[model samples]
Target: MFRLAAAAACALALGLAAAPAPTSAAERLTLTSQYGPGKPQTLLWERFAEILERERPGAYDINIVTNGALGGEKEEAEAIRLGAITGAESTIANLTTWVPLGAVLDLPFVFQDAAHIERVLEGPLGDELKAAYRAEGFETPAFIIFGARHLLGKTPLTEPGDVDGLTMRVLQSDLHVALWRSLGANPTALPITEAYTALSNGVVDAMDMTKSGFEALKLYEVAPVLTETAHIWAVGVVYFDANFWAGLDADERALFQKASEEAAAYFNEIAAEEQEAALQRAMALGASRAAVDQELWRAAVAPFVEDFVRNMEDPRAVDALEMIQEAR
Candidate 1:
């Protein structure tokens, strides 16, 4: 009888101990991007969110904010720094705040193809760049390469001569300014959000942006001609604030990093496919698309590249340029 009673007591104790505690809700994380939802940037974030939810369960959740709804890239970056936001997908141009040396990546014609970009960015050099951001109080999970930048204009641009005396909208980067100036176009730096209106209002006759950006911004509606000059292959970095990152336990951090890298690879593959699709879609929408004369663009931009190389004091910048050229 005593044995039976003891067994019952033990079973009851086990049952009480095994009862699950209330599952805490997942912590919601917000990721801000300059592009609109349904675009490439937001698509990457969505994939990341899915992976995070699957891997971390109740650990973390991601909410993507796009279309400058949270403000422009610069503003969003500042928010991340101030701990007002958790993460952001930012262009190298905007990332210049944390790592000024990153601006070198914006130079025209530096990265020849996606393979070349991937090799450099996922290799030792890319690791170094990631560390640079870490030093500035951020966590860089992975860098994703986008399609090559091309010139889209209201007027046809087959060669450098066509751009002469044209007012061109460019990102506020010294490298971009130098490249545009060398090509004889008047360079005006403006935020990406204002680019569409500026183009429609005739504030700028030409702009350099990826084919996907052209489609997303509906720039094709106004600028009917897109020249595949392929001047620059831009890259976007996924970053988290160091404080928020450090708060995560080891397993959570590993899960986030793995998910981010996978999402970045997915973004690169999708971006390549979308680049051709965007061009085809533009043509269907009554836009004329053509390839630029490489020789002419190279000739016009060579001097600018030379000047840039001479002025750059960072050996890593020079090495990155050379490595990319060699890979090409």
Candidate 2:
């Protein structure tokens, strides 16, 4: 019995020694988002993390903190730029606060359609934006096209005239405020986190948001009317801290590049599905929709677009618009 016990102990020790230990702890990177799980942007980050793990197993331990666990858009963008947090999913409107050239993309009707968007993203415009953002401590790896922004209201709101004299919830960007003001609305800049509550309490009568966000935040319940302005397609980026990016070696950078491209393609594909489903979900929840004469909205904003480009702080804003127009 003693001999058998000793033999068992020796065999167990040998087996443990034969097994290989883990190479090293995976590099920890945390990404922030204002959307929770099942939302498009949150899914985009999850897809990105999955691709990284697939390409280099055990090399990256990526954590996606959702529903603004880190902060809202403005705070998260600042965090990424400061390297206080590793990364975040952010919009061009948010970045325009830092890089004014980004406002070109925010112009109404800049993107004619999906194919036009594809041309611009695959063209020199993306490269230009990437370089510009890198100068501002953000290493923008991927460009994503989210759903278009539309007007939402508790009342049956439909045309450019409908928003006139209404208190509107605008993004935490001056550009959004200026755009809504041009339409004759009283624009008030507010973080998306406060949009629902503001709408609930009559602080704001109308607001603009993407289809997916309208559904994800259940703003459809508060503002039960959706006007499909399809004004500006929400172009967003996977922004990483430039310092964090600089610390990566060539091989690691290559993995990130590949992962970003794959994940972006994945996002654009499913985002359309999510947008369609969002409307259906909203309708089921007692929401109503109105069709807009898009050409009218386009005409209304044409002058504002021109003025916005002219007054932009960045000279390259003109060049950015030229690239997008050339692509079209």
Candidate 3:
């Protein structure tokens, strides 16, 4: 019996030795964003990956692709839908193509401030948006503010009337087109990739973007005039591939969610500060800056906002709009 037991132990040891060794690190997953390295959008995910790896070492490996290495924003969104990629930092405006109800968030003058945005998005309205995104097979775990969008124009845009007859580069989103048309501007739809050339060649006299966006794209070099329209507070939606998310165990998923939220909060606090600094730097670099009558701009766009909410298909849009307007 002792010899038999020793033989069994030897057999077990040999079998264990023959088996493949366990991997020390997890397989890497991809995270794609249009923003290239050193951009704030990419920096958010950089921080997220760092936190995730530090907290759950060897459990998750994230390979981040910036500068639209995988594809443009719309293409990346489709990849997420098809499970071709793990996740993307998509603009809320571009996401409208998949989830049309998301356009409500792009409505001009909808949000009061970052605090107001947080309150509405973290509460019932946010819940509804999440459900809407999930219905379309995507999930947004967190939202990062880009900053209040302003007008960057070769000509000064100090008031709503200044936009009249000007050719402006608007986002490809439907709502953006409609908003600019309502303001009496000849809206030209252009991708960010083509915006610099269009601005330089005088194809478009004006364009709207946040301070960071202007700095990232170096638009101020061409447009030269920064008008603080604060028309809309642009936000980046953190979208995860639903199938990829479902494949993860509960613990792994929780780590992702926690990291996203923590990274979002960290960036949110500094977004405003960065916007201010970006504007200062642009001015120092020879760009002119001016402030518009925000009240007049809001009033000019009020009709469009009212019509947008009234025409929304989602029953939640009404409540969401109300909730945002009423948020302190």
Candidate 4:
């Protein structure tokens, strides 16, 4: 009888211990990044979640999903808009589907260097861009750097002429198509997932990508050549769902914004360090590196830039371009 009573007492103790403790009202948010684990983009979101939880204590809990577990950027973006998910990361180029002016960031040669890109995105130009996102129902525009995009090709790109007649993979943005076409390459729009197979099988001859992307996708094994074109300052922006954001109090919003800003600055530093490492890794894997003929490539693409600017319907496009150029 004593053993039976002791067992009953121990069962009661275990039950109580297994039950969750009572806590204050807490909101749960889901944040997703498409990048795989250990990539800077994935790590940045992880740190952001940590900051949010630390700031709010039991008031909020943020769950992060990495490696496109939810979906690719576009699919995740649509989900966020419908309030299916709380938030996701996106490139300015990809955001063009919602905000046409987002293409301004993807235009080649607009940013002279990383510093110039940073200044524009952190200044009035960025303010305008953020306002556009907010107007369209996204909130807290946080910029994430993916480093400078370079040419990854099956053959060496010694001059602008080398790209002529070669089929190159491009993003799903019209501007990318126009840019590559202007360079005399036939631009093919392929989802990044298919790029490795396409390159290895000779379906496409070249692609424009960042060191981080090249390394992450292991495309060097197929392409084997990295040209330092640094054509555009590749960037991705993170925005929250408008409904979810509006539900948050001012303090909550401020806390998130602060965390995003600090995290972006931190990410840029890490990207700089990773850039050298990615280059070394690619070279060690038997990839050849080459210098681009910038002047020649710029001269070839100048007409396209002018035509693009002349066709902008929004006057804000002119102002944005001016601000970007002055930063250089």
Q: Which candidate is the best by TM-score?
A: 2
* Residues 1-328, model 2: lDDT tens digits: 6334434543343344332435678777777678888777778888888888887888876667777655568877766665556888788888887888887888889888777887897778788889999999999888888878888997766677888899999887778899999989999888788899999999999999888889999999789998888998888887888999999999988888777778778888888778878988989999988888989988989999999998999888888898999998
TM values, all candidates: 0.88, 0.90, 0.88, 0.88
Pick out the ten consecutive residues of candidate 2 with the lowest summed lDDT. 10-19
Which regions of candidate 2 deviate over 4 angstroms? 1-24
Q: What is each predicted model's overall lDDT from 0 to 1?
A: 0.79, 0.82, 0.79, 0.77
Give the candidate number with the greatest lDDT: 2
Q: Can you write out model 3's per-residue Cα lDDT over 116-216, one digit (the tens) per residue? A: 78887888877877787887888788987878999999878988889999898988788888888888999998777778899999899999998977887
Ranking 2 against 3 by TM-score, winner: 2
User: Is 2 or 4 the stronger prediction by lDDT?
Assistant: 2
Q: How do these models rank on TM-score, best leading?
A: 2, 3, 1, 4
* CA-only RMSD, every prediction: 13.1, 11.6, 11.8, 10.5
| Residue pairs of candidate 1 with colliding backbone atoms | none
TM for candidate 2 is 0.90
Candidate 2 global lDDT: 0.82
Question: Global CA lDDT of candidate 4, please?
Answer: 0.77
**What is the per-residue lDDT of model 4 for residues 1-328, given as tens digits with 9 covering 90 to 100?**
6334444543343344333434756676677776778888777787777787688677765666766655556666666776656777777777777777878888787777777788888899888888888887787558877788999987788687888999998887778888888878999886676788889999999998898788888899999888988888887787888888888788877888888877777777787789879888878888878997788777877788888867765667877888888888
The local lDDT score (0 to 100) that residue 69 gets in candidate 3 is 54
